[model samples]
Target: MNENKEYFVNEEDFIVSKTDVKGRITYCNQPFLKIVGATQEQLLHKPHNIIRHPDMPR
Candidate 1:
């Protein structure tokens, strides 16, 4: 795994997404896909926690 790699959202870009009432992603824009490093098929209907990094601070 590329643990040292990081993705950043450009200042001029916007992240957009829609999740179900249970917090499962239903739709996401390109910026969201880029930041999360996932394709639409990989993220659709998936839990938001799928993007949580183990090293991320609580």
Candidate 2:
């Protein structure tokens, strides 16, 4: 991971919440929340890519 990167939450499981620069619940699915073990509030502050699993190619 990039040490310079900063985020409200970390990508651990399957919570891939995509949001714009502003904090808003733009996109999210049931599987995302369930696998990550997080609520909507958690991703609200976090970035859209916080849930981007490492397996995803750059």
Q: Name the best candidate (by lDDT).
A: 1
Best by TM-score: 1
Give lDDT for model 2: 0.66
Window of ten residues with lowest summed lDDT in model 2: 9-18
Q: Report, for every candidate in turn, its global Cα lDDT versus the true structure.
A: 0.86, 0.66
lDDT of 2 by residue, 1-58 (tens): 6578666754554545666666555766677788777777777656655665899964
Q: Candidates' TM-scores?
A: 0.67, 0.42
Query: Per-residue lDDT tens digits of candidate 1, residues 11-30?
Result: 43888888999999998889
Instruction: Evaluate model 1: give its TM-score.
Output: 0.67
How big is the RMSD of model 1? 12.1
lDDT of 1 at 57: 70
Query: RMSD per prediction, one decimal?
Result: 12.1, 14.3
* Each prediction's number of clashing residue pairs: 0, 0
True-structure lDDT of candidate 1:
0.86
